[model samples]
Target: MTDVRSDDRPTESLRDRIATELGRARDRSVRLTEAVDDDDLVRQHSPIMSPLVWDLAHIGNQEELWLLRDVGGRTPVRQDIDELYDAFKHPRKDRPALPLLGPTEARRYVGTVRDKVFDLLDGVRFEGRRLVTDGFAFGMIAQHEQQHDETMLATHQLRAGPPVLSAPPPPPSVRPVGAEVLVPAGRFTMGTSTDPWALDNERPGHPVDLPAYVIDAAPVTNAAYLAFVDDGGYADPRWWSGPGWQHRSSAGLTAPMHWRRDGTGWGCTRFGRYAPLVPDEPVVHVGYHEAEAYAAWAGKRLPTEAEWEKAARWDPVSGRSRRYPWGDEDPTPEHANLGQRHLAPAPVGAYPAGASPLGVHQLIGDVWEWTASPFLGYPGFAAFPYREYSEVFFGSDYRVLRGGSFGTDPVACRGTFRNWDLPIRRQIFSGFRCARDARPDETA
Candidate 1:
């Protein structure tokens, strides 16, 4: 990880950028919550996820913990409720039974925290501790809020009701002529070492050597996944692993979550509205098991974590990695579907400008792509600030997912950022692209 030893302090422009990002994150959270009623906000849509109200207060609680208390050295605003909002202390299924702050109280608490945080940011020095240096604490808090915003979006997708959110459709897809592209054998850097706000898991950039392999030019779309469903892919035990088959059988899942057979066709529910599945859109909410099964059925495999990173960030010409597929510039509307600008994944091959150096489309956004690798730390990995953020989950049980999703904020999304969850999880915005070893007959 980069140490905060530089004498140079934050500039006015830097402060403004941080402030703008924080405001956008907070505003997005409010907009998502406001779209649902108080009853829906308190209702737990799934056992795995917390009630919307718990997340609202949890956002404030975390901002207060990091920005106000840790960075600004302030006393707690509501000391009695800290345990109630502690994620590690309480599980999601039990949170609804807790006495969480109501809508009015939660809004007031978050607003007050924001006020204090902004006040602290105005005059705070940005060169002392790691948390304060380069406004890392503020950036972290903003990212935390934005992450919760994405989680709340998941809640919206799970909630049952008429449409509570809407957005103009994304650009039409141009069906990629080549199904996949060959990434030449090479050594490439896999993570970041200098990004000031990058989390502990993405630190200490390392080298990885990979053989030539072919990866999908775009994510598997609804049209493609539907073919798997139509061919009894789920029922075939040959395509699924032992544990995967058990999970599929127990759940009685024949198709992706939120999808139901409508006579001779299929319809999917998104944010409480059911519509005919969009054939070209990247498939969302598929679990790791399902992604793996689909790959096996297609005579391919999921890309490893290293391979995925190499495909997205490696620049063969320079022998270096860029901060994003499109380069170091922050994301723009034309680059990818992000920041809740759209409630669903854009069509496959839609974001040509966001393509990587090798012409792989949508490498940075649309949905989190499941990889074949398990979630593990690098050779020199060490937890910073706290271990709970990532260290505890580094094991074979959780699968690593790369790229951000439609609800991901640009401030929180990066080429090296890592997300992980259990393989059985299908509620979040997750999908996958297929990969395979280059054949002897194939030429790059």
Candidate 2:
């Protein structure tokens, strides 16, 4: 909301919107951390993730740094502990021993910071500075918190216990979708230049010319992935890249994470509860290599970042890009399975309403779809506010993922939004759809 049209609003509306977003984000953070006992909050569920208590405090620290200190010109509330919460200063594996604030203290500190932010919001101007312009900093902080909330949700998925979370199931697929959609590619704009809250990596929209291609109408589902597993996809080196094969061999990845043998079919654990795999639901908890291997077995390949964007945002008739697959508007519940409305991905064709104009389905949410591209700044890219936000990670070390996942909050996800992780990571809610060069006749 802050990035879309925040500056166009009256001062009151802008402040109200920012306040609402901040509140919503905090609520999610609280729910995630509070659901578990203090022991669970302080324990590191996985080495790749921080203790839940650390995330709780870090969210407040970021808000204080950007909104209270930088925008409001206020002194730090706890200058001594800044390093304790600085993410770059400490990796997730080392966070638990860094004198992190305990559960009670973490909650109280964030509450204090939030109170000060509200006071500052009452008087902060909407212009005269880039960070404060259009309430970008506030919006950014809200997004940051939501991002951590998603991470904490992932941590919950990794935690060992009875179910600590629950939500109603996502709507079932309304109808069958075709196997693939042809993207009649030409020059289509990529990234964003006008979104008020768009992060640095997503700025400076540019046109990308390309040959036509074919892409999956929906993400690969459990049923489809099952075919790969049944065929010994993991054991076959023919389908995997060199590095991918090495990792698969060492890690002994037989199936998607949390998946185990059910008597007659496959079963998967979600938030500690196990159930039979829903054949039509998009597969989750997959790494890049697994997805790549599956694509190869299917006689296809992962889409390039540009190809994925063209399929999602390009409108053939209008010759323009939209903010989402459905249109320029923010997502509704019916649009996609986002914001943890469902604790897992919906069935492949469940969100036909969210389909792209080219007829691609479930493009915005359900799972983070891996792309062929590595993390890189767009052409003419420039860092803003800080390079650590995106620039520092611009290299082949991390692979790019488009769209958002069921754990993703809408504020932190958008058409141009970029997410990257080490290709070997299997703990996140990730999946993919395959693509291929269009047949000569199909291009027309």
Report the C-alpha lDDT of model 2 over 1-444, residue by residue, as the tens digit: 446455446888888989999999999998998899999999999999999999999999999998998999998998888989998999899988888898999999999999999999988998999998888999899999999999999999999989989999999989899999988858999999999999989989999998989999999999999999999999999999999999999999999999999887899999999999999999999999999999999999999999999999999989999999989999999898889888989997788789998899998989999999999999999998898899999999899999999999999999999999999998999999999999988865
lDDT per residue (tens digit) for residues 1-444 in model 1? 145345433455568878998999988998988998889888898889899989999999999998888888998888788999999999998999999999889989989988988898887778779887777888888888999999998988888878889888777776563589899998999888899899889988999999999999999999999999999999999999999999999989899999998898999988877789999888999999999999999999999999999999998789899999989889998888998888889988788888988989898889999999998998799888789999999999999999999989998899999999999999999999999999977853
TM-score of each: 0.96, 0.97
Q: Candidate 1, after superposition: displacement of residue 156 in Å?
A: 0.6
Clashes of 1: 0
Prediction 2 global C-alpha lDDT: 0.93
Q: Give the clash count for each candidate.
A: 0, 1
lDDT of each: 0.89, 0.93
TM-score, cand. 2: 0.97
Q: Candidate 2 — which pairs collide?
A: 3-197
RMSD to truth, every model: 3.3, 2.7
